[model samples]
Target: MNKEEANQTQAGKEQKAPKEMDANDLPKVTAFQDEATREYMVSTKEVEPGYYLLESKSKKIRMLFPEEGKYSDLLSNFSKNEEIIGFDEYDKEANILMNGQITYYQGQSFLRKTDTMIEIISGKNKYSEEYQKENKDNTEISIGYKKSNFDNLDRKNNYSYRYFGFVKPNQSLDEGVEYSFIFTCKDDNQSCSLDEKIARDKVKKMISSIQFSCNKEE
Candidate 1:
């Protein structure tokens, strides 16, 4: 090949090469709507000696978390990783959820948990594209907890936690943009998997405490 032709080929390859994703473009902890709003919120007094009440600044919502303990520290850090047991809220448009009804929103397939139940599911092959496609049209399936009922597809109980809940609607469901709550272990943590009772208790308390302003007016 000629020198000029070689130079042109190199330039074409460079142009076609995909750019690496910038760190800033990546989803940070603040990308979570609830965690971001907590920055501007007023810290409420402890609900009890060991638990403190957490409130959202804009949303009429409140929950309790451990005041001082290992769990407290873990929950405080909003960074996404495998070890931490934390909850996150984001706009439904950001379809990063898994395991449930596969529906299309804005022409993109989203795996949404229609049931308001907490369950421990196998992380094995959960991210496989084939698994997703298999359950794409399965709406009757739900992510609900059953005692000693582990649905490990590969017979490996490498479990992850998930509790998906939708915000309470004011009047009509179509009145406003809806947000979903994802209380998860983020990945397969053995400790998180075994601590189901404690996690379920705490999450139940938090969800029960949630009170909407619109509901109060009605």
Candidate 2:
């Protein structure tokens, strides 16, 4: 083809370029920065470097590194031995907890003394036998959202699950800090209705899309 004809054809193709995708399709995320902590939340994607973030009316997470043995930084503290300071917000009147802490230890005794928990839920088994047996063939790890339901361990009105197992900063496993997360509503009769189920699902969706990074600034 002639140079002039090729130029014209290229111009025509440029004019016919595809339309831009909607912002909704990309997953909307909001960033949160506090004096000692910073995090991000996505409507559809985890705010990342870590696994997930929980959606709640109130959001706060504290990252800490003990001067002693194993430590965790803000940028990479999923289930590491390092001490992390995070809490679950609760609606006292409704008796609803926004996100439950699955990790039982912060790796430092002194730090744990200063950090108090709002709520702590315990289970009988470390991992659900039924769930492990059912998905024995699946080697790939499963990340859950509102639709993903793990073992509740026969707890009435409780939605329980495990966070992505402890991922070290170097991405090597020394000790698995695989923690669990839970959502439950406290009612007069101790039963979860459709409303409670829906509420938990919303929180789960928030958790699935949660991600974070370190704020290195002093």
Q: List the residue pairs that clash in candidate 2.
A: 46-209, 47-210, 47-211, 48-211, 52-210, 53-210, 71-82, 72-82, 102-180
Question: Which residue runs of candidate 2 sit more than 4 Å off their true CA positions?
Answer: 1-80, 91-95, 102-128, 132-171, 175-177, 187-218
Candidate 2 TM-score versus the reference:
0.31
CA lDDT, candidate 2, residue 83: 30
**Number of the top lDDT candidate:** 1
Question: lDDT of all the models against the reference?
Answer: 0.32, 0.31
TM-score per candidate: 0.35, 0.31
lDDT of 1 by residue, 1-218 (tens): 99999999977654431123232432232321233333322333345654554443334444454432112232433221111223333223322222221111111112233221111132321321111111111112222232232466553444444433322323322211112222333333222333556545544444444444334554
Best-fitting candidate, measured by TM-score?
1
